[model samples]
Target: MDVPNKKTVLVIEDEIVLRDLIVKKLEEIGLGTLVADSAQEGEKLIKEKHPNLVLLDIMLPGGMNGFDLLERLKRDPILKSTPVIILTNLSTEDKTATEIGAIDYIIKSNISLDEVALKVKNHLQ
Candidate 1:
């Protein structure tokens, strides 16, 4: 059963270890989570679940990348307002990410799992 009023965060990442760590951190902080390995799956989850926030990775397995998904989200009338935080190893894409409509950009290597969880908590507020 779903927890009442629990905010769900969708993590779109291809790295299994990182994705699992992220989900674990978020869950430890009392948040619900949904995960996707590619942009297409992420988009599907966004449309269906309408999660409170999204933690997206830049490089994905599918043809569509995170930027592509971000653009699509920005263009969608209903989903445009959904908050997205770019969680990737790329430090160069921060400007492009924010300009493309992401609320924040996180460089995975530079941050700890605890910090990531804290950032997500702050964004959820």
Candidate 2:
């Protein structure tokens, strides 16, 4: 049930290098991308763009963190269905992430950029 022109992924990360790498990788794979350096901006983008998926970082600079944003997204009727993948170095367990409604948890240090692209591809499919 792929909707025409409905492929976009929003990335919420504060790290410049990692965020750029992710944006590049996701774009190279042909998925549209939107980015936010903090959860507040991410929330705004999510409301405006309605991206198909989200790559969320646990720690953020603004008042709200990724976990808080995740909880809010899960509670929202419109956003609850969007797939979210936790992309962070935080020690938050996979169980916790899943319980919070994240589709997957990815450790930035453990996976290559291409591997991240692969995971995104799998989730998008």
Candidate 3:
């Protein structure tokens, strides 16, 4: 049975290596993880799991991108308050991401797995 109080983090990243690494790092600290390779899957998981936070990647394989998902989430009454962190290689989108309701934006190439874990921890607190 799933624990009622267990905190979960959803990672919406298409890169297999990065996604797996992030999952491992968060799991090491006892946080539950849900992963999606595209924005569509991310939306489904968010609706079903109601994760505490989401780490989103801008570039996805599906028709919808991370920005679109973020916009949708912000528009939804229930999910709008959920903290979302934009994790992508695009440094230029940081301002736009914040304008769209992302709590933080981290450049993938600039941060380590440990940093990722730390960011998630901070947000969860």
Candidate 4:
């Protein structure tokens, strides 16, 4: 079934350009984007917006890092169901990411933006 509402994506990337790039790619594929510069902001957006999927970066600079946010989401009954995909350079964190309930984890610098879109589509579809 076609999801009637736009599939919203909350992109949490500390780098402005990278965040914009990811958002643009998602938009190009007809997905809505919510960009956040920090995990704290991203977590707030998740609570308020309940986006369909989250493109979370593991290395956020804020005090509430991505791992912590992921953990909170998993523990919260309201937020635990939202799908998350972690995109980071730290491939070593995959086990932790999955343990925290991320649907998928992709390494940056190895995957292209298009690949990311494909991954999102696979989950959202």
Which candidate leads the pack in TM-score? 1
Error of 2 at 19 (Å): 0.3
| Candidate number achieving the greatest lDDT relative to the actual structure | 1
Query: Which runs in model 3 stand beyond 4 Å of their true positions?
Result: 1-4
Candidate order by lDDT, highest to lowest? 1, 3, 2, 4
lDDT of 1 by residue, 76-100 (tens): 9999999999987878999999999
Query: Model 3 over residues 4-94: C-alpha lDDT tens digits?
Result: 6778999999999999999999989888888999999999989988999999999999699999999999999999998999998978999
Candidate 4 local lDDT, 16-45, one digit each (tens): 888888888888999988888888898889
Total clashing pairs for each candidate? 0, 0, 0, 0
Candidate 1 — which residues are off by over 4 angstroms? Answer: 1-4
lDDT (CA) for every model shown? Answer: 0.94, 0.89, 0.92, 0.88
Weakest ten-residue segment in model 3 by summed lDDT: 1-10
**Residue 35 local lDDT, model 2:** 89
Model 4 clashing residue pairs (backbone):
none
Where is model 4 more than 4 Å wrong at Cα?
Answer: 1-4
Error of 2 at 116 (Å): 0.5
